[model samples]
Target: MSNDEDWYQRYLDMQNEYDYENTTDASYVQSKPVQLCSKESLNNFGATIIPVFYYVNFLLSYLGNGLVLFIIYKYEELKSVTNIFLLNLVLSNILFASSLPFWATYHMSEWIFGLALCKIVSSAYFIGFYSSILFLTLMTFDRYLAVVHAVAAAKSRKRAYAIIASMVVWCISIIASIKELVLKNVSENQFSGLMCDESGYPDSTMARWRLVTYYQQFLLFFLLPLFMVMYCYISITIRILSTRMKEKCRAIKLIFVIIFTFFACWTPYNIVILLRAIQISNPGEGVSMCSEEESLDYALYMTRNIAYLYCCISPVFYTFVGKKFQSHFRRLMAKNIPCLKRHVSLNSQSTRTTSQKTPHSTYEY
Candidate 1:
């Protein structure tokens, strides 16, 4: 019995030695000088969080912007220049929200939709984004003209001019988004199955294209519009402070909200985009590169989600903040909901009396 136990122990030792040798040989054969960064955790986090927020944003933007559109159509005829701009802005929000479901599904899973939809959806998304910024900038300019250069702008701020301006903005947005339609397609990702993204170009060409796209968005869509909005609002503020406008307080409050919301939501995303462009231009080596990329990925994800929320809040800034819109909305609710009719009527009467007292107020809309 002792001899048999000794033989079994010898066999176990020999087997362990063989296994260790094989593992060492395998490791030597497969060893890499530099380890690749894994983004599995980031992808998982995005798949879990992004879809939910996107769906919520879609719902809120659709509801708010849709209600604004309905109120505008029902109560306020598109006669005034402001009303025309407002209509285009609401349309832009709806257009932007319309693409959210596709993106949400894309984030949740892979891009099951085909190549054609990939192109169309991508183009629509960018066009909507650019158009929204343009419309908001145009609105600010319109307000500035109405408030700062009232007499000078009266002749030019016609409905015809507004329509023409909206058309021109749409053309610019579409032109800006042409690359999405041209370059985006359904491609296979090794880790994530298929995705809808830019493809079909040489590596160098694709890299250049991406850099151009980032700068285009950062400069044309974000920075330019931001500067324009800031200039207009600052001018408006100065004019209001210098004058004795009855609605100066409300104007100031609206301007603050607009600037604050725009800056808070978009600045981070633009900064992340600019950083990504710089990183791509000059990529670092090894573990540090991996870490920097991971950080940027996380930042882009978070800041993009924040930026998307702007559409959801746009209706509040553009329409709900206006007393005229409030009166119209209340009247609209009163028309639909019989229970609130009496209360709304009384409120409308009070609003009308106040408006009559201040008949020449240009800031009502």
Candidate 2:
């Protein structure tokens, strides 16, 4: 029995030694280093936590943006130049939010849909993202003209001209997005898994073009517009404070709140991306260009998640704040107090009759 036990122990020791030798072989040691940002790992992250959060965010943003669009479209009162710009903004955001599901799905797994979807999905993202920024910038400019140069703006804001300008903005957005559609391609990574991304630009020319495009995006979309928004709001704020016209003050306050809300939702993402662009020389990394590009990627990913939260909830803010809500509350009051409606109707009729009777005759003759 003792001899048998010693023989078994020696056999176990021999097996362990052989296993260690095989593991340390040169061939085994030369095996490929595992990629940290591989499809499998990214998918794991995307599938488990990231997708669910973004999906909920996307749903909220879609509903809010869609509601805003419907309000602008359904009500003639909400179809003014101000509301028209907002309609376009909401439309762009809706389109942008719609792409989140595809992205979330992609993050969960490899590009299973195919090549065509990759192009269409990615192009929609670019179109919506670019157009959103452009429209917001246009809105700010429109506000600037309306408030700072009211006479000029009024003269130029003819219905036909406004329609044409809106068309032109759409046209430009389409043109700008064409490159993105063409540049993106689907290819397999080192691990034999497929990925739908901008790939196969081996030359410096394509690399440079991508880099330039990213910088352009940052400058045109974020930096320039952000500066303009800041300037317009600051000037407008000063004007409101200086004049202290209590009647117009509420409207000015609404605009300020809207601008602040925009900044609160987007500034972190923009700043993080800008830092990333500064760090990376490549166009693909985007906001991942910071010194700690990998860490930045993770941070941008997290920040984007946070941005979506803010953006998705922004509509709720819009619904509750400022003149929109105040008017709604007043309507509720009118509903509860039917007598107030009768008085308002009577006053409106009286004013209309007086205007019809007097008009140009009382003013000129």
Best by lDDT: 1
Query: Could you report the Cα RMSD, in angstroms, for every candidate shown?
Result: 8.8, 11.0
Q: How well is each residue in 1-365 modelled by candidate 2, as lDDT tens digits?
A: 59999999999999999999989897778764433343354445556878887698788987777655654454435436766676667777787788889888877767787899899988887787777777777766776667666668778866666566677778777887887688788999865468898776776666566666667666777788788888986776665556535444555667677777777767777777776666556433323333255566666777777766654555445444433433444444466799787765555565456446542211110
TM-scores of all candidate predictions against the true structure? 0.88, 0.70
Candidate 1 least-lDDT 10 residues: 26-35
lDDT of each: 0.88, 0.67
Candidate number achieving the greatest TM-score relative to the actual structure: 1
Among all windows of 10 consecutive residues in model 2, the one with the lowest summed lDDT is 356-365
Candidate 1, which segments miss by more than 4 Å at Cα? 1-35
**Cα lDDT of model 1 by residue, 189-307, tens digit:** 88899989888888898899999999998999899999999999889888877876676787788888788989999999999999999999998888999999999999998898788
Give the Cα-based TM-score of candidate 1 against the true structure: 0.88
- What is the alpha-carbon lDDT for the whole of candidate 2? 0.67
Give me the runs in candidate 2 sitting further than 4 Å from their true place: 1-43, 77-79, 190-192, 203-206, 247-256, 282-291, 306-365
